[model samples]
Target: MSKAYNETVALSQSGALAALRAAVEKAQEMGVPQCIFIVDPSGETIASLRMDGAKYLSMHTARAKARTAASIRNATGSMTPEFAVAAGIASNGGVTNLPGGLPIRFGGKLAGAIGVGSGTGDQDIEVGRAALAAIEADPI
Candidate 1:
């Protein structure tokens, strides 16, 4: 038997680092200490940063949120109640129903995801969006 495969794109390490830096800068601008996480489409960590004074719990939550976005290929907070329940089971508790996670796309493909924590949900989402904007401006 033969198997077929299709090409896929993933966020490069440099791209992930750039996104992390952008999130950090955004957090600083907002005067909010935060934990920022970037992960590949497979939910593997590419880069992460925990700002000074960020809550320890944010470390775990940030990564979980990124994984949730990557796994679902959508913003974590956009999931419907039923989809959230299903995603939670499918991700084995790695999914987070939070507003700070966003799927990263490049060249019309799912590249990765970014998540921010240790701030209000809206602030976190802002930081994540800033990161995505940075990545878009300087692609890898």
Candidate 2:
């Protein structure tokens, strides 16, 4: 028998940091405090940050949003209610239906995800999008 291996890309610390900075900048621009979380392709945390005055609960929510994005391989906000029910994502632990989560892609492959919290859903999503744009410029 022959054995084969699967190769996949993962987010690097530098990339995560860049994304985090972008997210923070966006949050600042929007006049909102935030908690940002980034995870690897395997749904492992790479880096996280909580801006001053950010809600304490946002810390856990941000990580959960990142985990959800990594697990579903899609933006958490994009998951429809029906899809969430069909996929049982609504019942999954550490998975959120929040709008802050965004999947990170590299070379057309899923590399990881980023999540932002402590702002309104739309604001959080905006921060996530900014983070994604920064990450796209320096894909790891």
Candidate 3:
């Protein structure tokens, strides 16, 4: 038998927008082009943005990073790079399963996630961090 699921609070569209704007602005301040993604608790994308100069290929990787963060509720970097590689996810091709992606949590509940790419992994993480800080949130 299949089980039914009840829904309650979810990641607000406005929240995602605010979070994304903060992140993009941070990246721009650092002069680091980037692709940003915001995904809901279910790992579904809610918002996304790609700054000019950010590689086109980085878009999908940005989404993957957001997916990983939302699903795992942890910063992608918290998981060792080796782990990501073993799972066939890394900077290889269009995959950036690195430290720059992070989850968005509120009131101890999963809200969504944000991922940034197109720059070095460290730069990407910085952008993600700035966004979370703006909202007083964390990656998980």
Candidate 4:
């Protein structure tokens, strides 16, 4: 029988953490406090933080964002709004279905995800993207 050999995998959680810090700092500098979340490949929370001015609602949004990214393995925006609406994605019991959730990919493999909330959707996404970029994790 032929065997399927697997290559060793590597990921820089440190990179992801660094990215989170940088992104949070950037948000702070912009005077936009936010809730940030990071998750592992399996969608387990790795780290999370809420800035002083972040909204309480963002706590749930942040978790939802991370879950959406990990479950779909794509950026939250990847799902067209039309599809999201049709599928009730924005409704209760559906995915977060917002723009602030982004999947983390490394070496063509899903590495993890990041989510941010407590601002405009665009702003949340920007901050999350900054962190993903810092970690060198490809955004899906």
Judged by lDDT, which candidate is best? 1
The regions of model 1 sitting more than 4 angstroms off are 1-7, 82-86, 89-92, 137-140
Which of candidates 2 and 4 is the stronger one according to lDDT? Answer: 2
Q: Which ten contiguous residues of candidate 3 have the minimum total lDDT?
A: 1-10
Candidate 2 regions exceeding 4 Å error are: 1-7, 80-92, 137-140
The top-ranked prediction according to TM-score is 1
Steric collisions counted per model: 0, 0, 1, 1
Ranking by TM-score: 1, 2, 3, 4
With a 3 Å backbone cut-off (N, CA, C), the pairs that clash in candidate 2 are none
Task: Judging by TM-score, tell me the better candidate of 2 and 4.
Answer: 2
Worst 10 residues of 2 by lDDT: 1-10
**By TM-score, how accurate is candidate 2?**
0.83
Sequence-dependent TM-score of model 3: 0.82
TM-score of each: 0.85, 0.83, 0.82, 0.80
- The whole-model C-alpha lDDT of candidate 1 against the native structure comes to 0.83
lDDT of 2 by residue, 1-140 (tens): 53222234777889899999999999999999999999987779999999998999999889988988888777887767877555545456477787888888876677888888999989898899899888783232
Cα lDDT for residue 18, model 4? 92
